[model samples]
Target: MGLTELLFVKMTGGNPILQGLLGGIVITLMNTFGALVVLVWHKPSERFLDASLGFAAGVMLTASFTSLILPGIERGGFIPTFIGIILGALALDLADHLIPHSHAVLGYEGLAQTRLRAVWLFIIAITIHNMPEGLAVGVGFGSGDLPNALKLMLAIGIQNIPEGLAVSVSALSAGLGAHFYACFVGVRAGLVEIPLALLGAWAVHIAQPILPYAMGFAAGAMLYVISDEIVPETHRKGHERWATFGTILGVMVMLYLDVALG
Candidate 1:
């Protein structure tokens, strides 16, 4: 058999590298298609959108905590994992604070003048966020723990779809070029994952000792996202109750999936 065939067989047998690639693809496609659908059906309501975004955030936060951080602690011991998590959160927090996140345009003059700039800013933030997300997925798959990795990937993918829609819908509400812009942003987020996955795979191979730290680091970054972006956005309209419910539901969903898959 040829090299391609050999690789294919390995993949079919549940290779970590293949799993990571598949996971990345799954997330990318979901974001792209989901955004497209949202663009096609445009209905903007602040309360509804906030609640939905909250739900997505909840799903992502739960997965990051349970699947990634906990596993890292279990494998790498408490002190190291805790340090890693702190460092990770600090790093992302620093980046988030330093980086000027783009907000959707409001007001007619603001919309007309800063539309493109806002779109680009949004894209950049999403890209930065997605890169780490992809890395996390890759790390999960590359760990040689197939079942958990697959479950995490599936969960993340599901969450990403709504995220895509949220971005798309938000842009549309701003009266910018929603469809094309959303597609571009969504695809960009997913593509950012590929390089991160490769890098994560290499890190795993080179520094086995740092693997848990890396996972913790990712969890920290995700936690930042949940706290800063997801929570605030979700409660934009005082739908705290719905957001809380969504978060609980998200945690339950991920837990159920983890159990069922395991």
Candidate 2:
């Protein structure tokens, strides 16, 4: 069989990878749908946006530890998981230095800051934030643990709603695009995950041993983003108190879901 046919079969034949991709896509779209409020109604307040960002970050942090890292250690072992986490964090750190992106409140970041347009900068920021989410979902499925994968997917999906709002608002505030168009931009940020999910699934399915490492890597990547990017963005404004409360709520919600569903 051709490689294309084999992939088609794998994806269509009840592959967890397919499930992860579909879940990611649906949630990502939901995120953009959240952004529609700006077009259909009004823009969210900065305080509200800060709180939402904190909430998403909290959700991601919980998922990384509970859903990704723990399972990774169980499947592979401490050494592999640890190595994967270090590598993952390093990879994102390098990207942060090399890629030019803007924070919602911090203006611009990264070393290669040329005269790029605000739209591209916004896109870069979104890419930095959303790429790890896709990886986590893919790695969750790749670990050969369907229940945890579903839990991770649902957790990420729920948080993506607020993330979408944050991204759309950031893009609009940066003057990247208009109403519905801005929402489209926010949605486009997550489109990179389809291929990423496929890659994660194929990798782990082919080499099952790497599943744990991959999971750890995904977790690390997400942690880096949450700590370095999302948290900073949330706290950069004066709404740190509200953001902290939002983060606590997010953690509680995810913990409840994990316990209830798991």
Candidate 3:
């Protein structure tokens, strides 16, 4: 398909790249705001962190299906989406093998230990966790469906708040300064999203045939993060009950947003 046809959204002024950039910015800002939540909730308990992470997992769980997988099926058929999902999961799994990183609770994983400090390893984990989110937003915008894009954007941004809070809180638990470092993390997170957003938009520009696969890929990556990291980490603490409820609430919120936005 032609570039013009690929980006033909009459409602949003028909600029997928710009829309994709904005989508990335909105989610990044949401994450930044999430990080800043540390100021108010200062010294939030580990129990709270578990619940928040669970909440993030819930949002992602639903978002993976509603915003990515289902639409991908509708637009491009099930086979491509299924293949995309498998490929996406494998890609992240491969990253896990190739890149060593440490989680706040799960501790160190990936390639054998290097000189990376605990803080840096921790940052690596978060970065790897966040890349899919950026990719999802970019693909949503790239889909040329403004309503779905905005809905996905809102859900992802909301979920990000908890993630950002979890990150900043973890930083503080490690005795890192909250403002400078947290904000720095937020900026770094944005850097991860913006260019990737452009890339997603641009990728679709080159070939519409890949759109379904792209959407499925994003969904699968998110599903992997939720299952492998967020859920397990949240349950490791003593707050499993609260964390479960948090996930329920998060799922409800995303569901509400999906209905409301549409």
Candidate 4:
């Protein structure tokens, strides 16, 4: 069988589209697991949160390079991937410049600075960070390579656990009231992926040629988040060592999974 067909056999037993949507939903829901931590235990320490964010940054940075950009280079060549990366970075730069959002500890970013409540600001910050992950998942499936897409889904889902915890912590710090509500808010923040995944798959169907560019773009977008948002947020506090270890661990785990699953 061909590669896509073989990948299909390995994922969901046959249907790439169905598998794609299901994978997207499953990965996004992983966010709830982190949020659930708040219900079972006390809020995590700032050091723990910083490490988690750093871990997430590591995972995404690896995914961008190993999973997305390289595949784009293989499929569409160097020039396309290069341009896509630049465009992706530029797109994120524009969003960062135009939107107003607050980081976990870094205060407010984006051009449209505002006096918005901390909870809302936290939501905006995470939303911007996560939406691209959903897109990456979608693009993976859109590439018609079920195994690669599944790998991306697994990687992103695993990393999202820490992200969910970070979001819950941010909400609580913002005085978002009862632990249950904050956890709920954190889990719900990931729900945007449900639709975006489907849309990305559909876009792929409509324009198959764009797959390589899309992959590169997704990589660039994710890289932007890692460098501009997650890394800085992780290091803004005093847990630089823990965060560094977390980042190393995260990268190793993702690499292992990629090899094991591939």
lDDT of each: 0.71, 0.80, 0.83, 0.82
Per-residue lDDT of candidate 2, residues 1-262 (tens digit): 4453345346657576676666566566666676665676557899998998889988998999899888888887999999989989999999888898877687788876679887888888888878888888777776667667777877988898888877888878877767777888887887776667667767787789888889889989999998888888888879999899889988998899889776
- By summed lDDT, the worst window of 10 consecutive residues in model 4 runs over 1-10
Q: Write the per-residue lDDT of candidate 3 for residues 141-243, one digit (tens) a residue.
A: 8888877887888888898888888888777676556566765664565457777777887777568899999999999999998888888888887899989
| Candidate 4 residue-wise lDDT, 1-262, digit = tens | 5464465566656555556676679877898898888888666799988888788888898889888999999999988888888888899888887788887677788776557776777787788888789888888887788778878998999999989988887888888878999998898888877677777776775687887888888889889988888888888778989999999988998899789877
Candidate 4 runs further than 4 Å off:
1-15, 113-116
lDDT of 3 at 77: 98
Segments of candidate 1 deviating more than 4 angstroms? 1-14, 105-116
Name the lDDT value of residue 167 in candidate 2: 80
User: After TM-score superposition, what is the CA distance of residue 131 in candidate 4 from its true location, in Å?
Assistant: 1.0
TM-score of 2: 0.91
Judge candidate 1 against the unseen true structure and give its global Cα lDDT, from 0 to 1. 0.71
Look at candidate 3 and tell me the lDDT of residue 138.
88
The superposed Cα distance between candidate 4 and the true structure at residue 256, in angstroms, equals 0.7
| Residue 114 shift from truth in candidate 4, angstroms | 4.5
| Full-model lDDT, candidate 4 | 0.82
